[model samples]
Target: MKWLKKSVLLIAVFAVGVVSGSMIWTSSANNTGLVDPNRPGSVNDPLITKSYVDQAVAGQVKTELEKQLQGQLEQLDKMLADKQKEMDDKIVQFQKQLDALISKAGGMTVVELQPNQTMYADPGATFIVRNGTTIAVSTDANGIPDVTGGKDLMDGTPIELNHMLIFPREGRGIKSTHSSTVFVMVTGGYTVMNPDGTIAASSSMDNSDQNETAE
Candidate 1:
């Protein structure tokens, strides 16, 4: 009888433990299911939201586009500067060439004469005679000489002798009997002779015509 009672008591205790364990497990599972769905580590939790991902992608794309546009603008600016410099250089070269052509066509030639040096002039040419820092005579188209424009000779200004003393067709060409400086302008070449009548120098005349001045 004593053994039978003990066994029944042990079986009863074991059944009670099983029932309590089952109830505790059921309650825990129910509480786990009721937890906030949006909490971290939950099934419905979002690692990265849709809106955030979209904004990030848009920002990245905008940055890239801006960089590309800046690069293109820089390239264009460089090209324009290079072209402008090339054009400026070409213009300068062209002006130089034009000036050279004009000088060869019709330019003035200055001649310095020693004392008693005679310069023969052409029949229809003109000359400017200066004696010791003074324009003694300026000849006209008719071989007439005068000192009309000599009073306005400013210091450091080039003395322009448009027309001056003329030499006769056959006489002692500008005898220069006295010491004098002579400037001669003619359509053809002329001969400069020393007092001994020997040719000292000869030169051809060029026209002084300029359309525009270079910068």
Candidate 2:
């Protein structure tokens, strides 16, 4: 009877040892190396690391795209500024030409442009008559050339007096003969000087009888 009791106790001890070993094995199985390929992970796929890589690549791509777009926008801004500057320069040039045209008006030899005139270019530099005779265009009190006197006589401000030509009934004459500047013109027979009076330029004669002049 005693031998039988010892054998039964020994069997019970073996069973307990087997259960403890199995518990230890199960706890260690949670590691990456012990993961079962057949069973999917609870939080992530244990067999594939591609999901994390894709996310990282997508973030980098987005950053690069933003940088490229910013660069393009900056370039566009510079182009717009350049175009605007070009347009402004053209407008300024046109305004200057118009002003020059307005100042080129001349008057008859008998008449003169008075001080404080608003002059305009015409066939003969003619301005508003005063007592049937136009105002006199004169040099400055100290003998300086009075280029602005013509425009001033035409009801213009003296500050805006940069002008070159005066229109006459038949020809365009210069503002005055006081200066050495000459206005060469082709008249009835030959090239004629306008202000200082001398032939300077030439052109072929043709059927066209219209008065032609050269500066």
Q: How would you encode candidate 2's per-residue C-alpha lDDT over 100-174 as one tens digit per residue? A: 454354312212222222222333332222121122233322211224353322221222223323333333222
Q: For candidate 1, lDDT tens digit of each residue in 1-215?
A: 99999999999999999999989987886688754667886678858788999999999999999999999999999999999999977975674465455446766334445566655555544454433332222233333333355333222223333434433443223434434443343333455667676666655422321111100
TM-score winner: 1
Top candidate, metric lDDT: 1
Regions of model 2 farther than 4 Å from truth: 1-18, 24-62, 105-215
* RMSD (Cα, Å) of model 1: 18.1
lDDT of 2 at 145: 26
TM-scores for all predictions: 0.32, 0.30
Local distance difference test values of all predictions, in order: 0.54, 0.42
Quantify how close model 2 is to the true structure by its C-alpha RMSD in Å.
13.3
Clashing residue pairs in candidate 1, if any? 106-207, 127-164, 138-164, 139-164, 139-165
Tell me how far the alpha carbon of residue 140 in candidate 1 is from the true structure, in angstroms, after superposition: 27
Where is the poorest 10-residue window by lDDT in model 1?
206-215
